[model samples]
Structure formats: structure tokens, C-alpha cells
Target: MNLFSEIRGLVLDALAQMQSDGALPEGLSFVNVAVEPPRDAAHGDMATNAAMVLAKPAKMKPRDIADVLAGKLATDERITSAEVAGPGFLNLRLAPAVWQGVLAAVLEKDTDYGRSAMGQGQKVNVEYVSANPTGPLHVGHTRGAVFGDALASLLAYSGHDVTREYYINDGGAQVDVLARSAYERYREANGLSPEIAEGLYPGDYLIPIGEALKEKYGDSLIDKPESEWLEELREFSTEAMMDLIRADLKALGVEMDVFFSEKSLYGTGRIEAALKSLTDKGLIYEGVLEPPKGKKPEDWEPREQTLFKSTEHGDDVDRPVKKSDGSWTYFAPDIAYHYDKVTRGFDALIDVFGADHGGYVKRMKAAVSALSDGTVSLDIKLTQLVKLWKNGEPFKMSKRAGNFVTLRDVVDQVGPDVTRFVMLTRKNDAPLDFDFDKVLEQSRENPVFYVQYAHARVMSVLRRAAEAGIAADDATLTEADLGKIDHASELTVAKKLAEWPRLVEIAARTNEPHRVAFYLYELAGDFHALWNKGNDETQLRFIQDGDVATSQSKIALARAVSVVISAGLGILGVTPAQEMR
Candidate 1:
């Protein structure tokens, strides 16, 4: 029941009628036509650009087309007035009954009221928070985790078949370093002063991994050299660290559908297979890369290497797949991973990376393009840094993580709901300042609190109505004579509710879940404004004294607000507050 869509359909029907009456030319494309909310609410409920976009194409003046279109639209019962304004824009004021139907539709649909089929169930793989299994996840990974999880939920809400995935960096040299670090902790647990090397991980989180290693081996490998125990401990320590990471994510309410091991691509033909697929297309070659720009020739040395013709697919230059020493470069495994994703038959791929990885974006896209032959699209979203503040000062780092704040530290302090909601209050590409004091504040300045307070207020209304012996359930609310809701304040809320379905489609199309949070805040503002208005105006109050029918109609609108808030918060993985503490 999208009113904007319905109105757009009416506009299209009118344009077709105009063409049929020979007042307009035949065979004009209406793809550019759009129906959207007017920039100024005081102007109209909705606006359309059909006449403006078609004017030049139809060889007619925009105002002339708008005048004729307005006449056609005025015939519809839903549109109270269609005024041609500003060259060719058509602003429309919908009848009060149209807004009433929006409220009823919200009650009938419940949480699914704004769900959209724009994605059409296309398979999309969202890979995020693929941090190295070295220690607990920090504040940076927290933002990515929250953003990715919310994006996956948003896509699923809009009818995309989404797979939440984590690519483990367990096969790299970093894991070997982790093993040595854990070995030091093992010696410390065995009553020996361990040598804490400069390059070893210094976090106390590995102390348990070391103790676990001691329990498994029982000092047999304690005195052995690196060659004998390195491989065994590497595998064991990575598993332990991954367990810690999983627990951290669980505490933050994130669960991945798949955890891909980077080690799986090793000791197998996967890397070779991925490169061979590219080599078959004449993309692989051995060549000497030109020295990087702005360096003296004497300071730079050229080495022959196995490279992929990434330039053919939009990269700045051809990229090396294998170094002169014959080991695969970092780009090799990345190509193999994306090739694996393409082979899995996903219609699209989305990777959530930290902002530091911005330089890797184009090369990755090039690899996926070459692998899928432009059949699959890859969208990479980079989440910027999060600066934490508390009590007007920078927040202290977590002792457990050694140098950075852990995800659990933030979640434990504010709980998961606040942590997730606050993390997504900004665009992914923009840096976010998360102040602990401000987030916990219960004022309207705090978005999480404001949105939750709105839900809680609606719950309070439902409870009050229930205690007064009024039937306010969905079935009863749906049967209410909604025509009784004619107040301006009440209609303001209904107009906001009508934007939900359209906003859902917009957020999903742009792959931005923060838009949901923003919309919820605006909706809450409208609802709260109307609630405040009832204090002075007796008839504007939701529960009209001694009038059951009118009260039910008003209560119906309040419940509809809660329904949309719950759905929006659900997409953001925030549980709506039943009551504010």
C-alpha cells in the first residue's frame, strides 16, 4: 500500500489517457518520471516531475504539459488537488482518507509493513569484519561488524537473499607470529620467564591460548625448536583466537552465516585454478613493472614477475600475482577468494573494509570483473575510524586488547542495543565520534534514546487504553472509523508513516542502513510533536474521554507508529524499548 507508488500509477494512467486523446504524442518514455515527497511539506503531500522531464522530449512547453497533466490527476478521488508549480513541477495534496488508509495498511501488515521486493531475491554475499585472528576485535572492527550486519538485515528486509560472511586471515604470516606469541605465553604458564619479543603479540588475551597449549602438549614441545612446533601451534592458536573473536561478535549480537578459512586456498589448486581462468583470457604474463613514479632510477630496481593484466579491467596498472621469489603476492589469494565467490553463483558481492583499505578497492573490483567477466557486480564499503569519548575526555584503551578498545568493552559499558544503534548513526565512509556520556543521555539529542522513547511512549498508550477497558488490538484498530482522525497533528503523523515503504526501497537501493536510523528519528520527532500537542488541545488527545470510537481511531495511529519503529529498529538489530527505564 505505497501511496506514492499508487499516485505515480495514477499519473502514468493520466499520461496514457492524454496520449490516447491525441493531446500528447505517442511513444514517449516515462522512465524518467518520478513521484516523491515535496521538498517543503507546507507546499503539498507529494510532487511529480512527469511534465518537466517529458516537456523537451515531447516538443512542448513544461507549463503546458503540467497544466494538462494536472487536470487529468485532479479527476482521481485520492488527490484533492494537483497544482502545477514552478515551471513544470506538479505538487499534490492527497485527501485525508488516503492518509487514513496508510495507517490501516500499517496495522494490517505489522512489522512487514515497509518490507520491499526491490531486491527481487537476488543472491548477495556480504563479507565484513574479516579481521586477522590475532586477538579480540577492536573499535574499528566493531563499526564494520555493526554496519555489515545491519546492511545484511536491510537487504533481507528488501527481499535480497543475503549471506553474512567472514573471511578468516588464518593462512598468513601473521598466524605464525601469533603461534610464537602464544608459545611465549606457554613458557610463562610453565613457570619460566618468557621472552616477550618485540614482534610478538603482547596482549594478555593470548595468555589463555598459551595455557591451553600447555594443557594439550604437556611440556613435550616446550624445549623443542621452532621447526618442530611452529606449524602445530599455528593451527592451534589460530583456532583459539577465532573462538575469542566469535565470542566478541556474539556479545555484540553479530552472527555470521559463513566463516571462510584463508588456509583452505593453500595446499590446494584453488589459487592456480583462479589464475588459470584469467590466464585463459590472456590476462596473465611475466613482465618487469616500471619503477614507482617520482623516484630516482638509481633508487629503484625493476624485477621481472608474474603479473595479471589488471589494466584491462580498470586498474591503474598491471598488478603482480607472483613475486620474483616465486611466492604468491597478497593479491593472488584475494583473486582466488573472489573467484570462489563468483563460482558460488552469487548475483552480487559486497565487501565491508576499513578505510585504510581504500587503495585496494579498485584492484579488487578489477579482479572480480575479470573473474565474472562483468557478470557479477562487487560493491566495497569502507567504514572510517571511530573516536571514543567519555566524560569530556578520550576513552581509555582496553587492557585486555593491550593497545586498543575491544568491542566487548563498548558493548559491556552501554549494552549491545546502544552500541549497535550509535555505531550506525553516521555514514560508513565518514568518521564517527562516539561519546559515551552523550549516548547514555536520555534526551532528544541522543538518537537511540529518542527513537526508543517513541516506541516506549506508544506502549504506554496501549497499556493505558487496555486498563481503561478499550479494545485497541490490531483487529479492533483496523475496524475503527479512521475518518474521525481529521486533526492536523494526527494527519502529520500519517504523512510520515506513508514514507516508510518508499524509504525502505531507497535505503536498500543505496546499500545504506543508516538511512533507516535517520528515518526513525524523524518519525519519532513527528509522533512526539503530536503527543505534546495533545496537552493543550482537548480534542487532539489520543484517548478522547467517553468517546470509544474516536479514541480507537487515534490509538490506531499511535500503534502504527510503533509498528514502523519496531521494523526499523529490527533492521538495525536494536530491540525496541517496551518501557524506558
Candidate 2:
């Protein structure tokens, strides 16, 4: 069904035949031979680097190889022309029936047409939005959540077994802080003036958690000692905050396959086990880390503490896994969590963190690398900041969140579909400016609307065809004579449609889901352009008055556009609009 792949296979077959006949040198590697869309449409349908890549290896000039390869490639039934351009790159033009066949293939396969087997069932663990389970998730966490979820879905579409995970920071002092913050609310629920003290959570969102605590514990525990209540309350409050977080993720349609607890690693000997694996490999030692260059850290003390020789594995400075007081350091639990993943038999681990956590990437990778003895790879993807815009200014802070815009605040304003698509319009490492006005604008300038409009317009055509008493059903459209689609514009769209399978492999190989968003935008644009061209040329119109057969063929093209749009939007976790409102 992939025309580009079919063409590439033909090219490889021709090269192999050349070697067998001694027309070219034997044992020449064709690994670098690629068939992809040329940068300029005027050049050809696809361009290949077979000749250029094999020239030096074969001990021949690029042009000499290109000339010989071109003579052999020109004989393929699908290849109408194979011309060497610019000293070795071969630009290929295919027969019109080739693109027509692609459109028919899309109709046959529907949305699953572009699904690829490139990942080969490798298990990839994606850890994202590991925000502290303290309160409502904010805008920064929103971006990371969307990016990680989309990337997981993209990898799954390309045949990777992806596990979406979140690591809770419940083992730290922050949850203790959350417990104390909720205690004040517990007192307030009993009709006492709650003291919102410094270093305590001041957000109004905790008011409900406090009220819930009173409903559960009432008057009996009101005057209890801190020693008796701290542990119980900490556990209760952390669970409550995680419930709030789960609700937020649900609001955005992000579901995690695992929610790992940092607390579990404590008292379970997991930290010791993780560090022992490193120590057994001579990567752990008791040493004082050299203070970061030219600056005194706030926690800098001359005392020797237990440290991991992280610098030996590529960190800037050796990191401590135990503090001076002999308690496990924050990095200890993280290392254990990752070691746990490695032990789970995952082939790769991808951690999605906020931009502020960029400094931790190197050490985290080093830990996984050393622990797995170079067998497993860890990729830490940092999602940069999302600047919110509304009323032509920044969407100001939320009192409920205490410091930033809660995920609910963003989703409630624009709905989940807009929020998800607009968040992915930028690269993961690049800052994205999301404007409330722009995302909702019903014009081509807005990619969110543009993509949906393309789908909705296709539905409009189907609806009209139905009203005209024409059979636009899949049964009819699937059997329509696509050769009747003869406009240059129609063929251009079919050619773009043929690139879907190729595009999926490219996006998965680079671990970049933004490419999917970008492709959807371009596809939507091309579709919109073709739709507009029908205004001047009635021959290209979706509905040909009084000719049901021709209308069915054009409707087949429109339905195929919907198939691709739905597939692309499914990967993004956004619903494709069937009717624009």
C-alpha cells in the first residue's frame, strides 16, 4: 500500500541484480539508499541517494554509479522516469496510476493504512509529568503531560509497546508539607480560624481536602498530638492529592499505565538494591562531591557523605545517594525507580520532565546506563514552558493553584481537543505560546481549526451526497473508479496521502511527535487548497450535478482525507471534528 516503499524495493532489487550480473561491484551496502519526497515538488515524486551513498564504497564516481543505476531503474513498470540530477541524486517520476493506486489503497485500508512495524515490538517506558502530588497540576505540567501522552501514542502506532508512567514524589518533605497544610483545613472544618502559615500551601483548593478530612475523622482527632497524626495524615493527604491529579489527567484524556511511588522504594530495600547494583560494578563510593564550579551551594558542608561516583558515568560532578545524616538522598529513590524499570525488561526508558529539570537529565541517563551495563538507553525529554495568552495578554495566575494556571483552568476554557493540539504545535524543547483567541479562530491561520475544518468539510460533502440521493457509502466509495479523478490538484493530494507510511517511520525513528502535528497541518492545508480550487474549476468539485458516478469517485477522495485526518488526530489524542460548530 506504501508506494514509496514499493518503489524503494524496486530500486534495491535493481541494485542487487546489477551486482549479480557484475554490472556493479559485489557486496555494496544498500542500507543508506532512501526513497523520500523531494524537497521541491517540481523535482520529482521522490529522490534517492543510492548512487551517492554507494559511490565511495564501490570505488566508483557518483555520476558513474547514478548513470548505471538510472539505466536499470528506468525499466520498472511503476517508474515512468528515473533521471540523475545534481551529480548523483536520482529523482524519480512515477506513473499516474501509481498515485491513483495509493488513493484506492487508502479507501481499502481506512485509517489504519499508515500503521507501521518499524518499532518491532520493543518495550518503551515513558515517564512523564512526575509533578509532586501536592495540588492541582499547573500549566507547566500540562505541556509535559500532553507531550508524553502524545509521544506514547505515536510510538504505539509505530509498533512499540509503550507504557505511560508517572512517578509520585510522595516520599519527600513536600507531602509532609501537604499533610500539614491539610491539617489547618481540618481545623477550619471544625469551625476554627485556620492559620495559613508561611511554607504551607496557601491555595484555596486545599479547603475541600480539609473539609473531606473532617468528614472522615470528625471531632475525635481534633486535639491529637502531632506525633500521632503526622504519619496517618501524611498518607491520607498524599492519596487525596493524587486523586486530584488523576482527575486532572482524566480531564485531558491522559491515562497512565503505572503510577510509581517514591515511598515504596523507601523501607523496601529497593534503594539499597539499586545502589548495590552500582556498587558491585565499582560505581559507588563514600566521597564528598566537588562543589559546583565557582559557587558555594546552600547545602555545602565539609562533611563526607555517601555519594555515587556519577562523574565516572558522565555526570558533571559526583552525586550523593545518601546525605550526611545517613538518610537516602532524593536522587537515591529516582535511581531505584529507574533500576526498577530496567529490571522490568523494558528496552528503553523515556522521561519527560519540565524545562527546569534539564540539569538532572545527564545524571539520570548515567544511572540507567551504568546499571544496565550499556544495554538499556534512557532519553530524558524536557518540555519547555508554555506561555498562556488570553485577552491579548498572559493568562494570569490561578488563586486555586496558588502559583500557576491549573490544567483544569486551561482545559475548561478551550476544551480538551484545542488544548491538546495547540500544546503540540511547538517542538518539545521549544517554548510554545498558546493564545486563547488564536486557537479558536475559525480560519486557516489556526492549525487546530484548520485540521478539524478539513474533516468537517469532508463530512459536509458526504451529507450533501446523501441528500442528493447518491450512494457515498464506503461500499460504493470503495468500489468507485478512482481513475476518473484526473485533476492535477487531485493527484497532488493522493501523492501526499501516499507519504503517510513513510512519515510514520520518520516520526518514530526521531522520537518526535511534533512531526505528526506538523504533517497534519500541511495535510490540512493541501486539502483546503484543493477544496478551494474547486471554486474555479467545477471539474475538481466534490459534487458533480446530475452525475452520481463521478460524484462517488470524488467522494471517495474526500472520505480518504477523513481517514488520514482521523488517524493523525487519534495519535494526538484529539477527536476529529465531524461537524464544525
Candidate 3:
């Protein structure tokens, strides 16, 4: 249950009662009223802006309304005290039983404690890590992959029907370059000195594709000109690179529900269909375009071209769909891709692009808006750069990936759990520094370790209890007399647990998975603080000697902490540690 929601309901009900009793005016909107954790724990368990938000609307002083609201709330058994603090804000201290109920709810719900119905099963398409199939996924794509994957999970947990998708950039010149690069590797495999062209991909990853090509075709395509083998090699090499990318993502526990190829849009008449839909709405036009504003391109010149009136939706300027040369611009395929997504009947579309694509956001959003007639919403999240560090120096690039650090490079250094957790420690829009040494370090500074350590500590408690022949399973904890969990330090953990459901809803609303990471870290800190307190206070310990009843009651709280942590970590695509090695 969402304790904050319940308390807010209590406040709203009291406000309605005040109006019924003629203590307040009728027809006051409670839309702006909010119940949230106080900024300072010293203030109280929770705080409400009911009086403050209602004061001016009701033509009454905030303190006067707060005083009346406090009296109404004080009658509730759950609220131990409702003190009007500051000018009008009401701070509430809940009874100990309420916190205990939170722990019991956690044990009953287990990993599903924070699962929400916020999305209401809305169909959401999350497209991410749509890297070119010319090479293995690099560190930049790794961040996007982790962010998108975690976001999909978070949305699904919140009741969205999420589809994880990857858009392959195989219909571009980059794939042509990949083919030529693999052709060179094929020559090398055929016992010939190959020419390593400057424009072609130079990664050693294509060597295997080349060897496979040699084994398949032998010397038949060796003497053939570029025309014959180019198309074949393009298809073959793109698939090979995709395989490498899939493995890289699999290593990090990322799996996509769909792998959409951009090439399919080219010959399949999909691009024309998408453009025609826009044309029907008079969005498509043949017009002369102006040079870019400010410092224009050196080749900038006025030319007649097919353009979309993107500015009519939200873009800064009308964008060209076809160049003056009568060929589709790079953006044409993207528009078709999004149009296809819209026609698939998704309620919302989320694209996770690299930070370098920040300029492309508004135009793409406008395109989706135009295509879907604003029926479907599109949210584009740009994942910022990731800087790798090792030994206090910038980490070097992967030779396998030629000039960039592949996703495998980071995942190999630390396992998938650490990699996934660390990637989300920062917001998707924030630049992250992935230090190999620091991430592996078992300290509070390392969020992944700190959170995992908390889960592991809880497991350790369960193991110790089991070894002592005490029943401490979730079933047992659910039946435990949680009233025995009255210690202030233990209740502090329960209070933190009470915030999980609220935090999940907030994170899903903002489309920020980083908030989950932050919440998990804070919850871990609270649980660890209680664990530390138990060392000096005998009654605070999870296992009370010669008193299985008291020990089970207290261990119930500890197990509840693990339940929420596992759920939060699961949303982040992180497996909670059962034990620390």
C-alpha cells in the first residue's frame, strides 16, 4: 500500500469534513494539495501542504486552516500527531503500528511491493541502442542500452505493456563501409595481402566474418568485381555485427523484443507510405529551403527540395525529407520508422538516443506528432556520454572494436550486475564516469556495492536464523507479531520502506530510472544504519538471544528491507546479491 497516498486521502477527507461542518468554504479544489515526506526527518514522518494550497482559494489564512485541519487529522488513529509547523504546513508523526504495517505489507508483497498500476497497461514502444550494425556496440551504446532496458522494465512494473526494440542502421553508407572492410578481411583470409582502406571499418571483429565468407564462397567471389560481392557482403557482415552486438547486450542482461532493420524501410515502399500519410494532411511540400541560420555550411545554397512543415507541429524550422538531388535524406527513414510504430497502435513511443542526437529530438517528436495526429505521445531520452577510467587514468579503447571501448570491455571488467547498477547511478541525461577501480571497491561510495551489501546482509541474517533453527521465511515473517518491532531505529527502516511505492510511481512518471537507483541507495543506508545500531543495543539486533519470538519480529523488518531492495533492483535489471563474496 502507498502510505503517503493513504495519508493524503486522510487529509482530503478531513478537508471535506471541514467543509461539511461549515468550518471551511464549499467547492475548494484539492488538486494542489500534496502529502510527502518532510524535508527534514526531524520535522515529522510526513508533511502536507493541504492548508497552504487551500488558504488563498478559501479566502482564509493558512495558519487558521492548518489549525483546523490539524485537529481533524489528530482524531485519526494512524496519525499520532499532526502539528502545524511554519506558517501553515502540517507535519505528521504516524503511530508505530502504521510503520509496522508497512513492514508487514512488504513481507506480504515481497518483490511485488512497489509494483504499480500507473501505466494501466498502455502500450509503450521503447526503442534504444539502435546503433549501426557495422560494429560492436561501444561504451556510448552501453549507457543507452542499460537506460532503455531499465526504463522498459520500470514501465512494465508500473503496468505498461512495454516493447523493447532496436532499430538497426543497415540501410546506410556505414553498412557499405562494413562490407568493404569485411571484403578486405576476406582477402587476408584467402592468403592475399589485403588493402586496409582508410574509410572502411578496421576492427579485428570482421576477421571472422571474412574467414566465414572465404569458407562459404571459396575463390568464386575473389576475382569478381565490387558490384557482385558488395551487396552480399553487406547483408552478411551486418548480420555478423548484429550477432556481436547481441552477445554484448546479453552479457549485460539486455534483451530486445524487436530488432527492426532500417533497410526494410527502403525497398518495402514503407518510406513512400509514411510520406503519403503526411502528404494527405498537407504537411509534405515541394519548396526551396533556406541556408541554416548563423554560421552556415560551406556548401550552403538555396535549392528546391521536398520538405515537411515540421515547424507547424513543434520544430524550429521546416525540415527536408528529400534532398535537391531527388534522393531521400537521412531523416526520411527515421520518419518512416516512427510512422510504422504509430500504426502499430502503441499508445506511446520512447526513443533512447545518444546525447549527440540532441539536435534531432524536436524534429523527430514533431514527425511523430504529425503522423499520429497527436494521438500517441513520443518521449525521446538522450543518454549522455560515459567516460571510462582505470588506474586513475582514462581507459583505453578496445582493439576488438578498433577505436572505441565496446560494451563487453566494461561488462568484462565488472560483471553484469555491477555494470547495470553503475550505469543507472546517474540520470540518463547526465554524463557518467565509470571507474573500474571504484566500482569494484566495496564501500559506501560505490552505490552498486552499497545497495547489494544491504541485500546480502539481510540474507546473512536469514541464514543465521535458519542455522539457529528459527523460522524466518517470508510466510513466517508475515505471521510475526510485528508490534514487537517498536524500536525507533527499526521503525526508521519501515518508514523508508513505505516510500518505495511512491518513489516507483514518481520515477515512472518522470521516465527516470536513476531515481530508483537513488532510492535503493537511500533504503540501503537506512537499513545499514539500523544494522549498525544493533551492535551496541542488544534489543535492536535482528536475532535476540533466547527469544525466537522477538527475533522473528525484528527479523521480519530486515526481510522486508530485502523484499523492497530486490524489487527496486529488479526494476533496474539488477539481481540482488544473495551473499557478498
Candidate 4:
């Protein structure tokens, strides 16, 4: 079903023939050979570099190799023409029937048309949106959540067993700060003027937490000192904040498969166990770290500490696991968390972190490498910032989230479909400017609208055909007179459809789901172009006036576009629009 892969196989078969004929040396590696779409569509459907890649290795001129390869390829019935272009590249154009088969395959496969097995069912753990459970998720966390969820879906579609997970940061000072802030709210609920400390959270979202605390503890915790209630309130308040966060993610259509707690790593020997695994390998030591670069020696003080030899793996310097005061540094729990993941037997690990955590990437990768003993691979994707705009002006912050916009706020304004699609319009590493005005517009300038409009247009065609008493179902379309679909405009859409399976594998390999969005936009553009051509040429229209056979064939092509679009949108976690409002 993958025309490019099929063509590549033909090219390999031709090379093997050349080896058998003794026209080329035996046992030459063809791994570098590739068959891909030509840079310019007018040149050919696909271009191969087999001849060029094997020229020097086979001790022959590239043009000579291309000439023989082209002759061998031209013998195949599927390949109508194989011409040499440039230095040694072979351009191929497949028969119209071959493109027709692609459309029929689409009808047969439906949403699974572009699904790939490139991942080979490898077990992958994707950890994202591990925000501190202090309040509702904000705009920054929204981007990570969307990206990670979409990535997990993409990997799953490509045959990877993906686990979506979140790491709760409750075992930190931030949770204590949240407890103190809620305690102030509790005092306010008790009819007392509360002290709003400078560092305490000031958001009004915690008012309900305060009222709930009053209902449960009622005056028992009211008069107690800090030591008497801090721990209890910390546990209670973190659970409340996590519930709020879960609701926020649910609004955005995100569901985590696992929610791991940082507190669990404490009160257990997990941290010691992870470090001991490294220490047994001579990676742990006690030493004084050199003063950081670009700082004066007098301004920096070096202290002896327990460190991990992260440099042995890939980090720029050794990292501290325990401070001079003997408390675990932040890196200790992180190492333990990754060690736990490796011990769980996942083949790969992917962490989606905010761009601010860019500095931690190297150390984290080093820790995973050391823990897994190079048996597991870790890929950390850092989602950059998202700047919101409305009416060509900077969007103001939300009072509910205190100083930032909450994910719920964005979803409430534009709904989850638009929110998810617009967030992924850019790559994870690039900063995105999400304009509320532009995203809601119905024009083609909006990618989400354009893609959805294409799907809706296909639905309209099917409905019109149905009303006209023409059978447009897949069962009928699969046996339709597809030879009637010989127009250049119709074949152009089929060509685009042929690229879907290839694009899916490419996107999955690069771990970039934005490529799917981009491809969907391009496919929509091609479909829209074909739709517009029908306005002038009655034969190009999908619904023929009196010919059911031709109408079925054309409608089949349009439906195929929708099938791929729906699959791509599904990977992005965006619902397809059945009709545009």
C-alpha cells in the first residue's frame, strides 16, 4: 500500500539483478539507497538515489548505473516510466492504475489506512506535564500536556506500547507553601482576618479548599501552631490541588495512565537503591565541585558533597546527589524516578519538559543511561513557551490562576479541539503564538479550520450523493469504475493520499507530531484545489448528474481524504468536524 516503499523494493530488485548479472560487484550495501517524492512534482512521482549511492562503491559511473536501473524498472508494469535525471538520480512515474489502487486501499483501510508498524511494539514510557501540584494547570503546562498526549497517541498508532504518565511534585517545599497558603484561606473562612504572606499563594481558587478545610478540621486546627498542622495540611492540600489539576486536564481531553508521586520515593529506600546501583559501578563519590564557570572564586564557595560521576555518561560535569547538610538534592529523586522506569523494563523513555528545563536534559539522560546500563534510550522533548493573543493584543492573565492563564480558561473560550490543534501547529522546541482571533476564524488561513472544513466538505458530498440515490458507501466504491477517475485533478489527490503512510512513519521516527498537522494542512490544500476545479469542469465534480458509477468513484476519492484527515486528527486528539457551524 505504500507506493514509495514498493518503488524502493523495485529499485532494490533491479540492483540485485545487476549483481546477479555481474554488472556490479557482489555484496554491495544498498542501505543508503532511498526512494522519495521528488522535490518538484512536475519532475516525477518519486526519485531514487540508488544509482548515485552505488556509483563509487560499484566502481561504475552514476549515469551508467542509472541507465541500467531505469531499464530494469521500466520492465515492471506498475512503473510506466523511469528516466534518469541530474547526475545519477532515477525519476519514476507509476501507472494511473497504481494510483487508483491507492484510493481503493484507502476505502478498505478507513482510519487505519496510514497506521504504521515502525515502532515494532516497543514499550515506551512518556512522562509529561509533571507540574507541581500547587494549583490549576496554566498555559505553559497546557502546551506540554497537548504535546505529550499527542505524542503518546502517535506512538501508539505506530505500534508502540505507550504509557502516559505524570510525576507529582508533592514531596517538595512547594507543597508546604501551598499548605500555608490554604491555612491562611482557612483563617479567612473562619471569620478572621488572615495574613497574606509575601510568598504565599494569593489565588482565589483556593477559597473552596479553605472552606473544605474548615468543614473537616473545624476549629481543631485553627488554634494549633505551625508544627502541629503543617504536615497534615500539606498532604490534604496537595491532594486537593491534584484534583483541580486533573479536572483541568480532563477539560483539555488529556488522561494520564499513571500518576507517580515524588513523596513515595521518600520514606522508602528507593533513592538509596538507585544511587547504590550507580555507586556499585564506581559512579558515586564524595568530592568538592569546582566553582561554576564565569564566577569569581571569592564569590563562590566549594563544599564537599556526595556526587554522581555523570560526566562518565554524557553530562558536562559530575552532579551532586547529596548536599553538605546531608539532605538529598533535587537530582537524587530524579535519578531514582528514572531508575524505577528502567527497572520496569520499558525499552525507551520520553520526557516532555518545559523549555526552562533545558539545562537538566543532559544530566537526566546521563542518569538514565547509567541506571539502564545503556540498555534503554531516553529522549527528552522540551516544549517551548506559548504566547496568547486576542484581537491583536496580548491576552491578560487569569485571576483564577493568580498570574497566568489556566488551561481551563483557554478551553472554555475556544473549546478543546481548537486548543489542541492550535497548540500543535508548531514544533515542540519552537515558541508558539496562539492568537484567539485567528484560530476561531473560518478562513483557510486557519489550519485547524481548513483541515476540518475539508472533512466537512467530504461529508457534504456523501450526503448530496445519498440524496440523489447514488450509492457512495465503501463497499460500492471499492468496486466502482475507478478508471473514470482519470482526470489530472483527481489523480493529484490520489498522489497526496499515497504519501500518508510514508509521512506517518517519518513523523513517528522523528518523534514530531506537528508534521502530521502540517501534512493534514497540505492534504486539505490539495483537496480544496481539486474541489475548486470542479466548479468550471462538470466532469471534475464528485457528483455526476446522471452517472452513478462515475459519481461513486469521485466521491470515493473525497472520502479517502476524510479518512486520512480523521486518522491524523485522532493522533492529535482533535475531534473531526462533521459539519462546520
TM-score per candidate, in order?
0.99, 0.97, 0.98, 0.99
List ranges where model 1 is wrong by over 4 Å: 296-299
| Of 2 and 3, the candidate ranking higher by lDDT | 3
Error of 1 at 350 (Å): 0.3
* lDDT (10s digit) by residue, model 4, range 339-425: 999999899999999999999999999999999999999999999999999988999999987889989989999999999999999
- Global fold similarity of model 1 (TM-score): 0.99
The residue-by-residue lDDT of candidate 2 on 85-119, one tens digit each, is 99899999988888888878888888888998889
lDDT of each: 0.94, 0.90, 0.93, 0.93
Name the regions of candidate 3 deviating beyond 4 angstroms: none
Residue 418 of model 3 has an lDDT of 92
Query: Candidate 3 on 315-422: residue-level lDDT in tens?
Result: 999999999888999999999999999999999999999999999999999999999999999999999999999999999999988999989998889998999999
